[model samples]
Target: MNKHGIISLGEVIVDLIATDLSNTTFQRLLGGATVNVAVGVSRHGIPSYYLCKLGSDESSEFVKGQLTKEKVDLSFCSYDFNKEICSVYIHLNELGERYFHSYVNETPDEWITAEELDLEPFQKSKLFYFGSGTLFHPIARKTTEQAIHYAREENLKIAFDTNIRLKRWESENQCRETILSFVQKADIVKMTEDELLFLTETDTIETGLEHMAKLEIPYLFVTRGKDGAYAIHKNKIEHVPGIPVNAIDTTGAGDAFMAALLSRFHDNGVPNNEAELTEYTEFANKAGALSATKLGAL
Candidate 1:
């Protein structure tokens, strides 16, 4: 029931990533967008709690070990002995583009229920972070809705990443509607350029910001990959140029960006003024660029 730091609610899984171009073998890595952010926050020496369910299998042990190594709080994380492990296969193309194949036909993460959640931590958390993928599942979707309602009732700051993984959802329209509803509830919303376009149905950045601003989300960030990121708030727009790096795999870059952004904001006391928000955004942009230099979600 700590009153500070962040709580990430979503799925946690093992990522089987091909280390070489031949694609014959792979290295098992711990990853999930929310889990990545949680790990990233812990790496920055921040207090973070990961809220999710995992199977009582080797993959689950691996995830717990990685999170423990990162110093993330696992008090709220559960291990279900009867559930199957959730896994993802990452295929990295020559162009550094990563494609995902999820092996979660019937998994524990997909069965998370609202009753299984403990609301005390979230009610007292300074920031509650979540995204779109988990909501694709019925139980997780309901649980997420309840968590959002509780966060709102407690006046806790909400940060949402519209990490739209189309293959995970039922339909594109459902994704947009679900994401937009969460966006309206979030005080800070971060999305890539494509995600923003998809959510807003706007062709231009100018029009996109206009649409997002109408949602009354105090701060909005649009990441442009290697080109860097942009921010919009109070009718002001600013662009932070990206740093050049010989890219390896571009996986988890956005989640890292969100984690860094939230950490910076939490460190800066949630940015009461425009100057503070600008400074936090710039710093986060740098953190994201730094993350891209790394090979994995770490």
Candidate 2:
């Protein structure tokens, strides 16, 4: 149980990306925001641990091989033969923006339990990362909250992402409530402009920012599709311009950005000033931009 390490908790699914829309062909790959972050950190030369569950299917086995190949620590991962690995078909526009066509709603990823994972890892990790996807189901939400409770007790730094998948939740209100609940517990929160508006129940991005600032969220990052991203650093919001790239698919870009930001957190610790936070934001924006230059989470 090494202290000061990183650990990510969330879903790991098989992403069937539509590489050729005209031909209706697909390129299968393992992806999920949480999984992307795990791989992203490892790719950046950090040995991160992933906590999740796999199912009793071929896709699950493939996921195992990929995680092993990525050099991510899977000692805390669990498996179930009764369930099948979930999947999704993502459609991409010329802009590389994603439109998910279909998702396998049934998966064992959300069934994660506290007893299934070693609690020692939580105590040893310096930072904990999780997304809103796991809040879709009661079982998953309970498990995730239990882990969050542990992180809190250990005084581990927490980072949360508002990765809203409307299809996963029953209602928009439920999603909003859960989103706010998790963000409240995080030291830093990342969201797209749309997600920010949704959580704030505001009509404009400015209005949303105004409302969120009242919540006293220490640091915030809002991603704008092509306009790049904005960040609230030391109580001041600054816009970081986007890096131009002929993106192949923008599937895992945010995860890339987050992984880079958190890896920097691991390297230099959290920013104590606006200058330092802005520098980190710019670096993370570049990491996301570079990810869009390629396809898939890898």
Candidate 3:
């Protein structure tokens, strides 16, 4: 909490990815959009801090151990005996495509409150990264909102990733409305092509980018899997080609790209010109493509 680095607040979950179509055999991996970004940033030699409420269950212990092993700072993290870490059962087909089969949680309503958070970490960190995963829960939403306001008040750049999970929200309209509200407050925002279309209610990617450009977001990226990504700033757009790889699993590729991009920003500051934007995007593209070649997110 006293360190200066990237700070992220959200749920820490374990993904039970199926090894076969039967869905009986599985492999447990530390999984969450925010967690992946934190670990990836730490691997880039940046001190990363995580804020969450952990428990004593096996899944919770596993999450704590993995975060510690990855060298993520946990001074801002809390604990609760009654709570339990969330678990997601994912199904993978022969082609390595993943599907969220079901979700399990013992205490979905229990969450760390905004009053429990310390503002010092936000003051010290260079950036604040958040996603929509925890926003569906009212209790967790308050904490996320507080952290965002604190980061803005302190003049730290805010990064928002619309990591949308429709299953968690009551309706698509609610999810869209809630996410767009946060998107307006971000300095840097990232989303997949599908997310861009969904948020803007546009039929094509070009119109979606155009719609987002009107929001005046300083930095915007729309990732297109193996095709690469697009970077938009000040209404200027640049397409950065992606690195091709024989992807076996694409679990955390976007998180990898996000971490690499933020790491570059932390080390060299945000890209101001077209050339600089392409350079940073190219660097992140490689990281993402490489992650897809592996079996796990970490």
For TM-score, the strongest prediction is: 3
Query: What is the per-residue lDDT of model 2 for residues 1-298, given as tens digits with 9 covering 90 to 100?
Result: 4566788998888888777645277888988899999998898887788988877688878888989999988888887776677788888777756687887756444477866767877877888899998788887788788888888888788889999998778899999988898788888789999999989999899999998987778779999966788889656988888888888768789999999898888778888777788788888888998898885677
User: Candidate 2's C-alpha lDDT?
Assistant: 0.83
lDDT of 1 by residue, 117-233 (tens): 887777657888998878777788898888888788877888889898898787889889988987887888999999888898989877887888788778888999888888777
Ordered from best to worst lDDT, the candidate numbers read 3, 2, 1
What clash pairs does model 2 have?
A: none
Question: Residue by residue across 1-298, what tens digits does model 3's lDDT show?
Answer: 4435899888898999898878899999999999999999999999899999998888888888899999998888878898899888999777877887888998988787898888888888889999999999888888989998899887788999998988899999999999999999899999999999999999999899988888899999999999999998899999999998999888899999999999888778888789999999999999999999998877
Q: What is the Cα-based TM-score of model 2?
A: 0.91
The global C-alpha lDDT for each of the candidates, from Candidate 1 onward, is: 0.80, 0.83, 0.90
Cα lDDT over the full model 1: 0.80
Of candidates 3 and 1, the better by lDDT: 3
Task: Pick the winner on lDDT between candidates 2 and 3.
Answer: 3
Give the C-alpha miss distance for residue 105 in model 2, angstroms: 4.0
Name the regions of candidate 2 deviating beyond 4 angstroms: 18-26, 90-99, 106-110
Which prediction has more favorable lDDT, 1 or 2?
2
